[model samples]
Target: MWNKIEMKRWHRLFYDQLVRRWKQNIVFAAATIFFLQFLIVKLHPSEVQEFNEAQCADIYPKLKQGLISVNEGMRTLVGHELKLIGEKEFDVTGYTVKRPLLNCLDQEDELLHRTIKEKYFVKGNVSGRGFSKPYEELKHPYQTQDLLELVFKELRNGFYVEAGAWDSEQMSVSLLFEVGFNWTGILIEANPWDHQLGLLRNRNALYLNTCLGLTVRPQFSDFVFTPAVEVKEGQWMASMGGLSETLLNPDSIKLQCFPFYSILMAAGNPTVNLLILDIEGAEFAVLKTIPWNKVDIQVMTIETDLIGKAGISGGSQEEAREFIISKGYTLFKHRNNINPVTGLENNDLFIRNDIVKKWNIKFPEPLN
Candidate 1:
């Protein structure tokens, strides 16, 4: 009996040790998996691209191939060449070339180069044109020239505002400063990560980490942020309607109240010479909410897409036009013309009439 009892006690001890080891192993495995996932997310292309790939899978084959080709061409040519010019201090006097190599590279490159140059260079934003997104094969023409001209034409040195600034490596505000737009504006962003990045990129620009709604002051509400920070009720949320509840996981979202009007008022109420709005689908709501008549805004450029999955539409663009027109602003230029049948072109511009009359800017013949 004593021997049997001792044997049972030994077995119990063994079982406990085995359970402890199993639990430790399971914990270690879980930690390892979490670490790997973190590394992948941090090192991967971008959250936007990932989301695009996952959600836009069906359109990926058509859009992705073209986007990649354009991206490679642009990456090889534009930003790199500009950087080289800066490093070497080389003069870009009449350095224009419609290279066939751009077409021969790939369908993506061909589409990208054509769209980027036409939209960005012809309209004037940057000095050169290139693909804004390479991997996705989406050709985004940087209007370096238009941007430079605007910077030089309007602001020698003063406040500038960039509304709807979001988190995308391609839409860096630093590029504005690099091309010499005196960083004087309120950088408004809704997403936490993008807002944080904007703050990092533009040190001189005052960063407002909230969405601009129709309200005169920032109001405390809940916002739907992805992966990093879920819904918290304490953060300030924009008052725009028609937001996707599923994407935001509305249940877990949090809201925070903030003073929107106070921040703008504090930003010196400087005459806004140039305004760029690319706030996804919320552009119309935000614009409608603002007292544009009271503000001395000079030139406004916006992105208009016929079938934006994010709910941007022609109606929104028209509404924006009407709003600007009501404020005695005229349409200066329209760029990145897209065929509703084919979702190809990325960046487009719409300038105010007052800017056109003042600058004597000529519009490029509409591309068929």
Candidate 2:
């Protein structure tokens, strides 16, 4: 009912107030977004370095003690997530997934994924075809065995000799090569309990219930056996197959021993494709006894940490490497990656230069 001039003025005033309010709201929204971005940048942490298993020795005890429950929990949770996502077989260990996952995972999944990303190198490729599990998802305590499998992905048949082959399948480096690659060889274990278990588990390989040394005997004494009488609940016992004579006590257990040369003769002196020697602390003595000229061993994995113990010398890493080099073998990989809590010794892998040339094989650098 107002006159035209009056109505026009009123409308302009109302429109002007609305425009001012809109501009104020825009400024407030921009300030809010800026504040949020600043908070995110300030609170975000730096990316964690890829965890080297060799460096994990210190953290292993905490994981075992449940002090760092998140690691175990993360493993189980990741395994569960894989199954839910229709992945029947996948490795949840510290070896999988090398890249960051920004928005591909949910909130909780993203957090756990980031935790793993911060610790391990993403080495897995899920889409590759004709590859039967780039690596074994389980069973191997470490990736050394699996990495060996990766190294020999070409060969169809070969021979292996596994010393200190605990329970044959449990942490047995030769098991995968034998089962997966159709290779055959010998398994040597001195522990009665472990030997019996190996017999039951490793049906494909020839099981030898004897120890390796420079001398063969129907029986040997003063070897330190584990599960000691003084072990407490939740406590563990330590036993190396052979230790320095100085370290052996009067109460040490007795076990049968044999010469490596005799074992080779019994096997018809076959060309050994791989030789895994892990006789605890006495590895070097047994290693020196091997007449490298007489045997044609292409590749060998030695647990050299045995030489690092007190009262154990002459079998030092330097001496061992020099001896193997003298025998025309080149160091392929030396795995010293150990967790401090476990005190696990490092292992060395060597390949004969002649055999490498013959087979046209390439060697990978030490993983540790």
Candidate 3:
């Protein structure tokens, strides 16, 4: 109804207004999104971990409340406490009770190359195919540790891979076997001081001063190992190591990390006679990362209570049990031993089906 110029002017005005409003709306929306993102990041900063040795010291302070970093990550270094009174050379010829710790620097790699058959068969008291005697009950906190020792007592030079092997001998499931039976293997500890103590105690076994992990991804950055002030003298804060950084105090040390397979390779991929895994709460991750095809584990004693309790998998103990069974192992015993400190029932022992079949290893009458 209007003139041509008037119509054109009206159209232009309408189009301009529409574009301006649209632009303003878009800007508002974008600003809102940006503000929300900023608030989220600031309020709940996501954690990131890096595993660079060079960056280990530098990244500790920058780690948020919950963050970790790991890079590609062993050996027994003797502690100063156990002063070597006798000769430094480790010799188990007579099974002396008062033997001092020996430096395992040179002997670690050599032991890794030795298989279970070679060590136990050649050097051990393998009079029969396996132990024919009834399993004995020892003075151990959990009867399972002694039971495990008795199962393979006939095999000398037997090998064990103990994750989270704290103090080597103190409450160690494999300590009796190593000292009495002449077995040797690798002991992995996350705490630097404990690792040193492990080295001093376990001269026969190779000790690794690192944490075993599932993925190469770093877990927490700027993690300091700080235990609660109320922790008792003899008790160890399990969470102070590789389990959770949140509980660590300011004095905690950064842990060197590695994958399970990587650790096996470093240990020359020996055939594992026994695998004792108690890596705080990261047992699931370590179990998941194990290269089943590469090694033959005859017996495994693992802490199962923390399986899906934490970490990314959110997996449960039943799921963990099922997973282990799926990997050629049978749940032999659910010990359900309550940890003296935490009072949590966590110990579960599994035996390789093939080993049980081959050796005809029958379940002994329950001692408990």
Candidate 4:
């Protein structure tokens, strides 16, 4: 199976210090196809004859008949050509034929935890026993573990979309839902942390190593990630970068950028149960991009502390709160506590109005 393949080559590229210093955004196509033929368990590309101008139209029918095998690894790539999302439709004649060459030079991406249960994931609260999967194992900075369980009555096999998902394991608000509840979803993280302790490789979620922006389309942006730690003696890992409206230095690390709505569409627009944002104050802008009417997100948790911080989103928590409330979400839960250990701000959980109406969740009262 594709999931069984060991993605050592792919992980190395993502984690390599040199690539971190040089190329941050890996081209989409080559990332999946570079070693696919060699590693796809005896599945090789079905070669087709070279196409001249005369044979241009012939590529269409051959592609229709599965004469070529570029069908694999075309996810989240080529907006104009593949039409994964946007006004354009899949242009078999224009784009399908170039898969062979593009695959050779595509950037590196490896889908981890596919065809397997999430690591350390349990079927239920099987904690405290021998070889048991404990509850509340993966702790979020904002106590989302308790928040989620209380809200859902310990619901399992749910779905989530976690932006700023750091390293799948540490302080990830979404991993506990996956590992403890057997839920699977998306994990979006970007650079600096990706270089330091970022870019998930073990979690069962679909990993997108990109930054979220308030955009109508998928694009690249300069990710200004300042490492909160030192790499060596008298040397810091702080590289100059900028956020959406950041007043930072000229030098910034460029990473793959996409709007929140576009990313949901790229991920097949699944109904997101819990949308958690902890991307260092980029939450407001990213949240604005989600097409609230089309996408059904039941609940959201945002780091509200960074709202008024200069060089961040340049917006206040009131603005963020107003924007969210306007989107038909009611502030479902909030606790007053800036996390001491991780220094994480308190996350305000907002439940969609429709969901609140459907579930009839009353604050501080258990649902029967």
Best by lDDT: 2
lDDT of 3 by residue, 1-368 (tens): 11112322354565467567767799865864564354334322223223455464444443322243111121112211221212352321110010011111111223222321232111222232121122242233353344554466467778888887765654467766765677888777765556644454424666665566555422332223322211234543323334543454333333325566655665667788888887645677667766687677898888766554433245666777788888988776544355444344556777788887787766643212
**Candidate 1 residue-wise lDDT, 1-368, digit = tens:** 01111322354565467567768899865764564354334322122121232433443354546553323322111111111221253212111112211222222223433433342221112223332233243212244345555433445565556655553234443334433544455666554444444443434555554444433322223343321111123422121222232334321222221223333444544676667665544455455555554466666655443212333222444555566567666554444334222233323444555666677656563221
- TM accuracy, model 3: 0.56
Q: What is the per-residue lDDT of model 4 for residues 1-368, given as tens digits with 9 covering 90 to 100? A: 11000222233344366355445556643553443322222221234223344443554445445575433333222111121112333322111111221122112111111111232111222232221123334235544644565566687888888776654554567666776688888776664334223221345656665566555433345454332222233432232123545544332333435566655655667888888877655677777766677788888877765554524545666788888998888874454444332243346778887787787777743111
* TM-score for each predicted model, relative to the true structure: 0.48, 0.55, 0.56, 0.56
Clashes found in each candidate (C-alpha, N, C closer than 3 A): 44, 8, 21, 4
TM-score of 4: 0.56
Clashing pairs in 2: 51-119, 54-337, 54-338, 57-339, 57-340, 58-340, 97-122, 98-122
Rate residue 181 of model 1 by lDDT: 49
Candidates sorted by lDDT, best first = 2, 3, 4, 1
Q: What lDDT would each prediction earn against the true structure?
A: 0.40, 0.51, 0.50, 0.49
Model 4 regions lying over 4 Å from their true place = 1-138, 192-201, 227-244, 339-345, 364-368
